[model samples]
Target: MVKRSRRFVAFFLAALALVLALAFVAADRWSRITARDNAELAAQSVARANQGLLVSELQKFRLLPLVLAEFPDVAEVLADANPEATAHLNAQLELLAGRTDAAVIYLIGRDGVTRAASNWRLRTSFVGQNYGFRPYFRGAMRDGASELFALGTVSGRPGLYLARRIDQNGRALGTIVVKVEFDRLEKAWGVDGGIGLVTDPHGVVLVTSRPAWRFKTTEPLSRRALEDAVRTLQFGPSPPARAPLSLSGSEASVGAGRRQEPYVAGTLPAPIDDGRLTALVPLQPFLEDARRVALLWGLAILLVAGAIVAVLLRQWDRQRMLLQSRAALSLEVERQTAELRDTNARLLVESQEREEATNKYVAAREDLARANRLGTLGQITAGVAHEINQPVAAIRTFAENSTKLITRSRPEDAQLNLGRIIALTERIASITSELRSFTRRKTPVPVQATLGSIVDGALLLLGAKASSQIEIAVSRADREHVLVGDRVRLEQVLINLLRNALDAVGKRPGAIQLTASAQGDRMTIRIVDRGPGIDPAIRERLFTPFETAKSGGLGLGLAIARDIAREFDGDLWLDPMEGPGAAFIVSLRIAR
Candidate 1:
């Protein structure tokens, strides 16, 4: 049972393992897909937020230069090249710069000279300094307003220059420029986490959260882009994006400062300044989450599979126990059968001795009683002797046939006849053994047997004694049905029921019906006699051992038969009814 159950479990586990593995594989694939998409979204969200904040910051100072250009004093310094007018404008410019949070505020003349400056109070002042090389300066002379990001020549601070043309009646006079710095904005992005960068049209990192990452290019710059950098001096004295790192796809490991870290990066176009925003997210946390889910699912599958296998093994053990019990029953039945044969042999010898010791005839009154009591016993004994006679007679005829074949000098024909004679002797022995076993005290041990076979064996043992009165008929379906009981014991039970039925009819031409049937898991054999039914007085103690209605009966036959039936997981009873004769029914378990 264990071995067979293990094989079943192994196959079960193998099938379950395959299904679970497929499920895990599907989950893993889904997790990877979801993680990748979520990473991109996370990076995009971070980029959009930082970019919006940076643009709003820069926009706050956009109108400053244009508004300052229309101021009267800012034009006074340029209209008259007077030192007193410049000094007055410089004082106003300094106050305005502090109010507007400008890094440096200055007015540049049409000659590309800084006529007035806010930082004139410091030693690195822009008064009387030439700014013709600056794009904002040249652009403002023709265009009304222009913003350019670059490093200041004097302050050396990197900032955006918002320059506006100073005009009177459509005639350009000088330009007003406001320089804006983003030290605060960059500092804020750093604290919020994730690397932030705003690149120019040339792809140069202009504003960044990291100091080391500033002015670095995400992709390679061409010679023209390099020239634009030189003219604008957007990176000041710093190198243009540190030889543009060799970029892979959105996800890759690259050096940030000194050490390389794995990252999943994404780009979003900035709506404010036409720059690109990029963010990188790590993959370690996502991987850990998928691993945890897989572990949990795997554990659950094992638990369920283990439970099913345990139940299957338990059922297997029960079946194994039933098989072992059946084997033991067969052995026990054989042992009892052998013992019955021995006991019957001893009893027969003792009976013969007692008969001889007693007188051949009792006195007149005792003779009538003895004849009445011993009649049934005499009939039963005659039946057994009659059963043995047929086989003995066949043996005698075959022996005569053998002798005649030998007289004809036909050795082969003689040998064939001799074999039949031997077979007949064995049949006689078998009949006697069966008769002895039938009369013995039965100790039933249940085993699987066909009801029909037991019924046929019982009728055969009765010989011609009950053949004329008894009509035995079993349904074809019932004949094939199995009963769980010792074969010999069941045969004995049927024989007892039949004999009682035959005796009930006696010499009368009455019908005794024997029929086999099945209901659910039970097999039944019914014997009905059409003779005077059992008397009410006798019926009360019908199955009591050693109490009999028949004068010669010890009454142990019906009691022993009932007991044997019960031992074989069956029952024998006289079913009550308003009928002509008694109906005895035997019921037993069907083999599974």
Candidate 2:
């Protein structure tokens, strides 16, 4: 009997050891796989974040030229030919350059002499410099339009240049050049541990995230590692099949092992006048996290095994105790059963509370939906009022004219009055058609529409209040000539902005300027008012539902406006204007 028991124990120990060994091997393999997957995911997330930052910085860089092109002063200078305008233009350029991130804004005359420059320190140096031979200036003059250039440092700063030739009739007058600082481009990358570089097919790093390393002619071993990693990494759709691996060496080792790791990378072709953009990232952190998870799983398996062993030992001991006192065991079992019943009752009440909470959430969502519907209805009403008021006002004017003709007893004058009345009635019919289209419930239909029409409709709705005292200016220079959006929704947005501007002006004699323009694939609309702007105290809460500055205002106008904009993939924001006014800017993406 003793020998049999010992044999049994020996067999059990051997089986346990075999199970542990297998577990350890399987766990290690799984840990490595999980780590690799996690690392790849992390690298992909980083790459996407980096890409967004790059695009944002590029947009910022583009702003320098765009802003200059839209400046009223620049427009005025282009329209007029006064010789003294040079001094005024120089001063304006200098002011704009100081306020912006541009390194310089220089004007080159048709004769190739640098006429006026924003950079005063370089004014004398560039005055006689003949840049007519420069590609940027020459190309613009020849094309009669704007041109972009990417070349070595023109003013000791490696950057992009935007040049537009000033033209009157068919003759070129001068070229306006705006220089963007490349150092700012490095700042945009914001990659701390590793460096990012824009490379050509020849393996030349054209631009780098590190300012100190940008345009440097040094060929380091790390550069070779990066090149090799780029070549090895699949960067294709099947991320799992082509894991990224990092090269291990030197200071560049930070991104070295990235080649074997999984990552997301996309090669973007160059813009019309720029080079390609390639992004790289590492997956070390994600891999580490996966390894940690595997370790935790291994620990849990070991813990469960230990618990099974304890339960088996307890059961064996219980068998011995039951033999000694069966009656005592029965009493203990009953006590356990009673305790379980009490615990179950408590769980039931807790579940009930959770159900109630869920119901409340559903109710809240229903309320929000109702509120949105009502807000849409309000916008439609406002637009209808604006659209119809114009024709009604015209009819009023025509009626008064007819009455005067009748009083004068002039038959010919009366005939002209009748013609005007007929024209006014036709205009009224057009207004009704517009109102029907705007007010009717319909599905979202995107189409190309002019922003000027929307602005006109919005202003007409508020015309009764604006009248003669308040000046309204509409500028479509910045707006996209053709936009793809829901006409009714856009009209609603315009109406909200106009109403807000009218409210701001109140009884005060102020000017409201509405301007629109297209930048890249986006349309921007700015509504500026020279009335008592919003108070700083309530500025942050301006768009919050039920938050209002006016006594009778519902405070939902701006909130609803924001919702409509977002539904169409747009944004609305408020900021203090450059002058003494408030500026509200709405941005929407242009449909491709």
Go through the candidates in order and give the clash count of each.
Answer: 2, 21
Highest-lDDT candidate? 1
Candidate 2 global TM-score:
0.40
Report the alpha-carbon TM-score of model 1 versus the true structure.
0.49
* Candidate 2 per-residue C-alpha lDDT over 183-282 given as tens digits, one digit per residue, 9 for 90 to 100: 6555655454434555444333446675544433233335564544344321112111111122221112222343334333333443324444444444
Weakest 10 consecutive residues, lDDT, candidate 2? 234-243
Off-target runs (Cα >4 Å) in candidate 2 are: 1-84, 109-113, 123-126, 130-154, 182-185, 191-208, 216-280, 309-592
- List runs of model 1 lying over 4 Å from the truth: 15-28, 243-253, 256-259, 271-273, 293-592
Flag clash pairs in model 1.
Answer: 216-241, 447-485
Global CA lDDT of candidate 2, please?
Answer: 0.62
lDDT of 2 at 21: 92
lDDT agreement with native, every candidate: 0.75, 0.62
Q: Write the per-residue lDDT of candidate 1 for residues 197-302, one digit (tens) a residue.
A: 6777766777777777667777778998788777767667555765223345677455656666555666777643466666656555555676677668778877
